[model samples]
Target: MDGSQGRKTRQVVAAIAAGGKVGRQKDLLACGHSEWSLRQAVKAGMIMRIAPGYYALPDADPLDLHLARHQARKTCFSKAAELGLWILNPVPQPHVAAAHGRPVPGCKVHRVKGGQTLMDILRQCVGCGSELEALAVLESAVVLKQCTVHELRTAFSRRGDGAARAVIAMIDPQSQSIVETAARYLLKKVGYNVQGQASVWGVGHLDLLVEGILGVELDGEKYHNTPEGWAEDLRRDNLLVINGVWKLRIPAAVVLYNPDLMLLWVERALDRIETASPR
Candidate 1:
C-alpha cells in the first residue's frame, strides 16, 4: 500500500469518528478518497456498511448507526429522552424525522426535515404521547431550564389552537421529577384539587397537597435511602399528622412502575376523607 493512501484512510476514519462515527460514500469522495479506497477500508474491517449510502465505524453508537442506516434524525420524545429530559413511556419505536416517506420497519417517521428545533420536537411530542406523558417531557425540559416557559409559549403561540396549546396551558415548571408530574396528573384526573410543591408554615415545601388535606410525598432513592433521611422523613410525617394533615409517602419505584395502585390508594383515601368531612 502507498504510504499516502494509508494516511488518507486513517484521516477519513478520524473525521468520521469525530462526526458521530458515521459517514457516507459522498463524504469519503469529498474528503478526496477514491471509491477503491472505500472498498479497501470496508474489506479491511475499518468500517461497516450501514446502508446503501452510509458507513459507520466498528464502535459507532448503535442508535447513531440506526439513524444513519435509515437516513433519519431522532425527534419528539426520542430526542427529549436522549437529552435527559423526562418521558413517561419508554419509546416503543425510534421516533425519526426524515425527508422520505417510505416506511422504515422499526421506526416512526415524522416525515419532515431532519433538523428539528427543541420547540419543533415539543410540538410533535405533545401530539404523539398521552397528555400526561407529553406534560412530563415538557415540564421536565422547563424545570431543568433546558427551555424556558417564554420560549415554549412563543412556539405554541405560532401553532394556534390544538392539543399542543392545551399542553402548553398545562406546563408547570415546578415539577421536579416524572414521579411528581405523574402523581399530580393522576390526582387531577380524578377531580382532586392538587397543589404541586405546596408549603406548610413549618414544613417548608411538600411534594403535593391534594384536597387541601392530604399530603403526598414522592421519595426517590437518592434522597430518601439513608438512615438520616429516613429519620427526618418520619419526623416530618409526625409533624404533618400533628397539624391535622394526613400524609402518604409514595416511593419513586411505586409511582413509576405501579402508578395505578398508587392512584387507587389515593382515591380511596379521598373517598374516606369526604365521608368524614361535614358538608
Candidate 2:
C-alpha cells in the first residue's frame, strides 16, 4: 500500500483493537497522522469518541474492535500529558506522580505515566480528562478485585476539580445486570439519586432503591422469571407494600430500553411517596 493508505490503515486498526475501550496514540502518530488527525477522525464520524481523546470503530468483528481499542490507548497517553494527570489503569506505574510533573500539595497525585485515562478509557468516557487517572484507578481497582464504587466513595476526597465529580457520578456500584446498571445510571443521569442492591427492611435485597421511594427490579432469568422465582418475588413484593413501602417493580428490559417510560414511572412513584411521607 502507498504511504498515505498504509497510515490510514493503521489508524483504523488502532480504533478497532480498543474494543471501544482503550488504545495507543503513538501508533496513530506512527501512521503519519498527527493528534489533529485523530480529532478530525472523531469529528468526521470516521470513528466514535470513547473518551476525551480516544475513539472507537464499533463492535463488529475482531478486526474492527481491535483497532478501535488500540487507537484509544494512544490517546490515553496524549490526554495524560495534556491534563497532567497520570493514569494508573490498563497497566501499573513504575515511578511516582510527582516525578511526572503532576501537582502535589496536600494530596500527592501519583502519575502512573499514562496507561489509561478517561479520554482513552472506554470508547464513550465523556467529560474532562482531569479525572482520567481517577477513572483508571477505579477501573483497575475492579480488575484487581478492588471494589470500584466503594473504593471511590471511601478513601476519596475530591481533587477540587469538576471532572472528579463527573467521574464519581458516572461510576456505579457493581451490578448483576447491565440493565440494572443502566437503569441506575440513567436515573442518576436524570437527577434521581439511586442505590443498587440496597437492603430494605422487608425486601432484603432490592435491585435498586431511589434513595427511599422507587424500587426497580432487574428480572434476571434465573431468579425472577421461573415459576418458583415468580412466586417468591410476589411474596417479597407483597411484604414490601404491606409494610408501607411505596415502590414499583420494573423489569430489566424496560430499565434498559424504555428508560424514559421508567423515569415517568419513577415520577409517579415519587409523587405517591412524597404525598405519603411529606419529608
- Choose the strongest candidate by TM-score: 1
Report the backbone clash tally of model 1.
Answer: 0
Q: Which stretches of candidate 1 lie over 4 Å from their true place?
A: 1-58, 159-161, 274-279
Model 2 ranges with Cα > 4 A deviation? 1-165, 275-279
Q: List the residue pairs that clash in candidate 1.
A: none
lDDT of 1 at 161: 39
Tell me each candidate's TM-score. Answer: 0.78, 0.46
> What's the residue-level lDDT of 49 in candidate 2?
60
Clashes of each: 0, 35
Error of 2 at 141 (Å): 7.0
